[model samples]
Target: MYGAFWRILPGPWWIRLLIVLVIVAIVLYSLVTWVFPWVQELTNATDVTVGG
Candidate 1:
């Protein structure tokens, strides 16, 4: 699967690396900005107690 994706990307090796980095950055940013907060709210993570 990864091999197929690498082949499908356009440009030389350095350009491909740059594109992959940009894609990773975008995914990480979205998770931090939106996905993680939504999941935290759904789970009520801050309300959990370690012991009682």
Candidate 2:
């Protein structure tokens, strides 16, 4: 979260910024690596079972 970055940002702005960027990059990579494949499979699946 940006809130985490803010706490770490008081010192050298570049390094904190790099950390934040890395975190965001990792999160985005995770979503692409995990969530996206699941979503594609679920949406593409023909035998989906939904309940209310």
Name the top lDDT candidate. Answer: 1
lDDT for residue 16 in candidate 1, whole number 0-100: 92
Stretches > 4 Å off in candidate 1: none
| Candidate 1: tens digits of C-alpha lDDT, residues 1-52 | 9899989999999999999999999999999999998998889766768776
- TM-scores, one per candidate: 0.86, 0.63
Tell me the deviation in Å of residue 34 in model 1: 0.5
* Winner by TM-score: 1
The local distance difference test score of model 2 is 0.83
| lDDT, candidate 1, at 50 | 78
Local error of candidate 1 at residue 37 (angstroms): 0.2
* Model 2 vs. true fold: TM: 0.63
- Indicate the residue-level lDDT of 48 in model 1: 60
